[model samples]
Target: MSERVADSTIKGFLYQFNKTILEIVNADDEDVITVEGVVEDVDVLSASGELEAIQCKYHETKEKFIPSLIFKPLLQMAEAYDRNPSARIKYTIFIYVPNEDHCQKDIDPSILNSALATTDQSLSKIVSRISGKFDKVEFLKNTRIVFGPSLDEIECSTKAALELLGIQGSDVDTLLYPNSIEKIAKLSSIKDETERQITKAKLYTYLSSATHTAISKWTLALRNRSEILKNIKQQLSSYFSQNSRDRYFYIDKNEIDDYEEKVVVFFGNYIKKYYSKPSHVTAPTFIINDNIEAIRDLEFRLYTKGIKANTGLVGNSFVVDHFFRDPMKKINRNHIEEREFDLRLLAMDSEQEAINHRKGDDLYLVCSNTPNNIELTDVNFYQVGISSFNELEYVIGIRNSHE
Candidate 1:
């Protein structure tokens, strides 16, 4: 027969076999339902009083086979069984092959056919292979089936076995139990940790870039103090005292100093908010090198013009502020000094060491002790300037030098 014809014949025989089994088992009034268009060659439902669900299968092909159609129904039955413990509905699967020789040559017919035989030698073998092997419940050992027959004889043989067993079907379990909340909780915890790490990484990148930009802008503004003072004055006018009798004016230096202090405070707050804890040190190792070198070059330029720039170690590293100061120029000197008074960078071997120092001081920069002088507070310190020793040959001037 053609493959299609063989499949159709096998399906018809399976349906007849299913009907016989249902009749022998005395299935429920609505339990002998037929499901069409299923991929399986034959599917049987027996919801009789004693039996929960039974599936029948017949293979016409010579190829070795195991029926996969029963897997879903078996799972459904197991779930139903779990819900109604008192429901004494048993599951059975029957597979009928042509004969012993036919079964040996093709599929391991013993796997599904064990239930029908008088002696359970074949069933015991299949059970041994399954017991303690899978995490889920094992297939029912109560299954049985008769060996093969031609299309005409298969249904009769199946009916004979069903009558001999005195099978009776009842209501099969229908409810599918939900998964436990503990499993979902574990998965959710894993997802939460992943998201937290992602957020921290993103925040770190944002804060690092913002700090770099702020430093760049501050350096540029310090270079052109007069223009920055003009801008600050213009911006601050709206906030100034507007009384006609009391005319309030801001000094250029004071305005510039206030702007610089604001920038410092902004950097401090940004670091506190996003980078409160020292994360993995992925930033460049030699960040201070270029800035230190630039300071040295500026000192050299001043030295070439016969100007002596006094440089001293404030906290640990040599100060570069002296080289940038112009004696004839004066803007916001008091405010600038006040903002720098407490701000000092301590040289450290690694970022971890720097973090450790900051942690000891509650993540704040500390200043070197100056004898007989009040310590500066409410300021910020940033590490800047070139980092090379070769650039140190250009030492020139110093700012706020009372000594």
Candidate 2:
């Protein structure tokens, strides 16, 4: 990884450790609140006002047990201790030494002790080389060396930390959920220790409510509303300034931070509203693969509950009673003639049943069975007529003729 990416990853791990493991374990201590962007990678303030500063070091390969490798952190610790003698601070050097293969293994404490005792270029030699500012005692009394955790440990701890923060059940799934990615990206900003804690607390509050709502809204759009999904994809493509010809766009976590606020707005003002519970009507029942019995039961329930039935079928409905229910209609006046004609044919079996089923409402049926042409006809009670059917053969013929 690049230095910037590596540092960012380390910083993320430290933040997780502070929030998830440290905070939860010290919940009652109150005094042991963590401070970030301060003297150390992880700083904890105790009840007596003393500070525990932990510095984390990461290496792609096992860190060499030598004075040059360990002297810088020791020097930083000496500086911090000198400035905070009254605060009685202790410094910890946490080293994450991964192998060349990128797998972490524990380091032997003796290796660190031996490095300090090296004769020619030892810790003492390094300290002497640094203008005699700090001695071996300062390094020994004020600082302790420790090893960092494995990659697996981080993942397990992350899961535990999220749970400790009350992100349980479905919210747990939201951790990897796509819509929640933008919210996570919004937290990428660097801030002082206090503001960081407060911001995360506020985020937790939002996740508790927004995660479920976002998930539900996404599910509704994917399952029932193709047009909504298409619009969302279009919006994303436009936002990213990608090829308009692209039919679908994948969301990346890195890019999410940039447009997260816009996503929040889209979800709040548009997507949620589109999928919100219908006040005047209930949810539409979609009969998958033309399940007759399911449609019959749904129609019966709608009749018994006196709920306006909003139903869509993918295939043919052989039963005439299915037609009697309210038909999906184009409400504009321009469609009124076509709408009336459809109502007439649907109610042809029994005008009284159709009238009774419609219950004095103008309802039209939306079907995929396109006849060659629709014939306008007048009939008793409701207009009923049948016309010849053709495939794209007639449409192609017309297009060719015009050409």
Candidate 3:
């Protein structure tokens, strides 16, 4: 594709991503958001169990609403309808035509029918596309065509929705916006449809814990930096104090070029402090985002430092298991299978491992940079504050106060 075409295509996906986030942010606690679901783009399963199927369309060069623009999308909806005619699914066509006066917020079925009768995509063709089945009146009744906000507007709506949910202030844009997008993108990108979905409870758990992100230093900025790291040091005291059960560190992939070194130092400091205390705490489960390779690389470094990890790579080969297990036995000083985690640093290959490994505290400290937020119901929860990793080092006793 041409550069401009590719850019437009990407922009279209961005619109869909932003729109999906808005639906999730505005949804009720029980609602679920599914990407690339029943319809082409996005779907929201409401608290009442009703499904709202959405198809988002954007044309930067277009001047007005074209009824034909929604025809194919409606056909996709029609096809879905044919699959289960009685399914309680609400079809939505979210479109944007540059001139507001020339577009519509709600589609007029009569106009839509008249357009279909004239356009090359006649009603009969739609039926054939859906294997000789289609709905006219019923489809229009269940279908909704509304004007979608621009990408920027949708992002603003996302921020606004977050504020309504109790997280507000300048950080909403600086930290929360792109961070939330990164999250939704991750969920939406998952290969499994079942895994490519999130509910309000899950999103809320992630949002509530993002306060630390508003202050931390990293390079994965979304918008222009006006005051991103502005006055960052002032907020360091509140970041992660050594005593808090929850500590979070935000490290966007590629955010730091020399992150392995930085992350090692950070993890090393926190690990020692966490285990050194009188509590039988053995180790801290390092929560990484979507990068397992980074986790493996990190394990090698930790092992070299006499600190080994239980990265899931074990069982792949004896060499793999031994490389990690030997050092862990020497450094962690406890059997990997020991259930006593209060004072035992544990090894984890995945988030599930940490969950299964926890013995005492139903709530344990999980530290990471933009951790893949798990549903609290699935076995996780968190809270934290920190301006910079250096500040975190000091608060967690990794760095001396005298320094």
Candidate 4:
């Protein structure tokens, strides 16, 4: 039973995420949303300097609204009000109501007073925390209960909200949900409260201007390789470009057979597509994600194929200039991520070279089923999961007819 996933965490994350999106879309230009706010799960600061503090909850198992479920949250809000009595704060509970038949006035002033003012031993400590600090009447008057849709229903509502903001054609799943959720998760992770907040304008810009770039390392780990690959193909196929982008290939030498052979095939095809038969396409840089030995082995393999890759620890003096007629698509002498080889004498500083020749236009993290930790060189990139050498060829559109 424990192993069976109910996806409760995912539901909660998407619910909060959808709510944040809706809030940003509906908010005035000056209103800003503070993710994982001090007062509640979300806080909306308005142009008039008022705060709309919201606590969001998604409980699919619960049959209906229950005052006791909100015991701790209400107490926390009451305490917040007590601490800053002068602040204009409006408390709201954004919760998934089990059904419409649930109690209508579930959180009226009288109901809140009855629930919070209780002397029940179980809730005595909770009541004690905010006891006599905030005016019960004032708190109740400002507080309200908002029933939300079921977990399944939230997506449609969120999509409707997104549609209002001009998103169309693409699946909302690939574009906004993870992107916005990723943004919120990043913002909330910051300890500085002010820094964690985003204005509606800035957030709208982020959501609209940026394309799908969900290379979340853990999310990648969680998904089945096929599902992730499916999503990757779907997303990347829509905006496929091989120019000015860096292709990062991450292969755990332990996961596959004849890894070097397959990698060479990947390289050959990559070169064939972009550089060998040029049709206005700029040759994208390649970064082999491996330890020194593996990279050295790849260098040796490519060497046999008469392809000189700048990857190394393979004993050989190197140069930055394309003097030896090195393949244009081969790794640069000063590529930042790979480990330095002993004989591959690089005259340039790797980090500065990386910065100077930024692969910021396009990027990728193509990896095997279990590659090393894939750190995105840039925030925007596509991830392709390759199971076999054949699949690697297929993903890069180099699957030979004979194979």
Highest lDDT model number: 4
Query: Could you report the Cα RMSD, in angstroms, for every candidate shown?
Result: 28.8, 21.7, 9.5, 8.5
Runs with alpha carbons beyond 4 Å of true place in candidate 1: 1-14, 17-22, 25-49, 63-73, 79-86, 100-150, 155-403
Assess candidate 1 and give its lDDT.
Answer: 0.29
Q: Per-residue CA lDDT of candidate 4, range 216-317, in tens?
A: 532333323345445555556543454434333434344444565566776666565544432323434455434445556656777787555654222453
The order by descending TM-score is 4, 3, 2, 1
Q: Per-residue alpha-carbon lDDT of model 1 for 1-403, expressed as tens digits?
A: 9979855663644443343333324434444322220212123234443443445455555454344433333443334444553544544434444443323122233423333221446434433444333323233432233334444454344334333432233111100000111111122234233331112123223323332111111222222323322332333233222211111111111123233333234223322322222221111111111244443443355455433233224454554443122223222533221111111222222111332211111111111111122122432222112111111111101111111
The TM-scores, one per candidate, come to: 0.23, 0.40, 0.53, 0.62
Error of 2 at 159 (Å): 1.8
Off by over 4 Å in 3: 101-127, 131-133, 168-170, 211-222, 225-403
Give the top-scoring candidate (TM-score): 4
Model 2, span 27-146: residue lDDT tens: 443444343437775566656777677776655354544444655666556556555555577777766555423233333445444554556443464434443343445446666766
Q: For candidate 3, write residues 1-403 as lDDT tens digits.
A: 9978966776677678788878887788788888878465888888788998999888767877777777777666777887788888888888766765433355677755554454464555764655445566777788888887666666677778776766545367656665676576667667789887887778777876664333222112234333333322234443334343433233343443445557667666666655444342334444544445556676677767656456544454323223222222322444333322222122233333343333322232323233344334443332223334564455344565412
The clash numbers for all candidates, in the given order, read 29, 1, 15, 1
